[model samples]
Target: MKIDTQGDTIRIYDFNAEECFRIARRLENQSLKLYQGIKAAIKDADIAAALDILIAEELCHLAYCEKALIDMGVDDINAEHLVEVVDTGVVTPLAQADIERVLCNRQEALKLGIALEKRAIAFYESILAETGNEQGRIALGNIIEQERGHRERLQALIS
Candidate 1:
């Protein structure tokens, strides 16, 4: 999306709505898989419950993205984008044991999540730069904030 910046407020528009939506879908899918892995890996009841909650949250995220696409008049939300795939990395399946082992060795998963979020933030920021409009900038900034939230949430889990 394109964005115009004025102080802390930004106005944004002119975004590749389809591309963003596609990215969102892929990211949500990745999150769901990660949580599934964590759920399988963690033997602790509390941790397993927490991972399940995160999985549910990602489901909501996917639904929210779908809704956003519909609201923006972007049809066919499943279309894949090379940028989303390449930039976000391959959607690998994490075994429950592999993810469960992470509770004691959490750095691996935490760092991966952080990297994914960073890439997502950069992608949206780049899109905003392309648009170079007020509304687009605003929208991209909001996305950046959202990515930060993801980072924060993941950090809580890891650290």
Candidate 2:
């Protein structure tokens, strides 16, 4: 999934429930890859353990989105097919290519994780506000809470 950004704003136009879920899953996938890469590079056992927890959490998130899409009768969601433009001031997930470049050290990795969680939380909250479906709203709320926890965990590591 590609995100189009204009300055500090992102524009995602004509997005439906399935599209939203796909985008969410894509974000989670990106997070998973990022954490995995950092974990592989970091030699600190404690930080690696923390990243392991985050990796598991991201896996669960991806599963949730997959199930949500299936429940909505969407059997297959291809990341390549994501073509919506969102216009919002929320923080966007880091691009996949930036993963290696962003991992300079443990502290930087932790900071990046915090920023990633913040972006997910903000994006979910924005979607929750606009979602009309009861199930979709509930799912978004749950994901928002999870993202908040992720942010807190990363923040604690930074502290």
The number of the candidate with the highest lDDT is 2
**Candidate 2 lDDT tens digits, 30-149:** 778768877888677766776776788789878887888888887566535533233233334456555554444556666667777877787777767766666666666666776787
TM-scores, all candidates, are: 0.60, 0.64
Q: How many clashes (backbone N, Cα, C below 3 Å) per candidate?
A: 18, 8
All models: lDDT? 0.63, 0.68
Question: What does candidate 1's lDDT look like per residue over 17-119, in tens digits?
Answer: 5555666677778878766866675666666655665666577667867887787776665666553554444345445555445575446555556655667
**Model 1 misplaced stretches (Cα beyond 4 Å):** 1-15, 79-87, 90-101, 105-119, 126-139, 153-159
Q: CA shift at 156, candidate 2, in angstroms?
A: 6.7
Residue 55 miss distance in model 2 (angstroms): 0.8
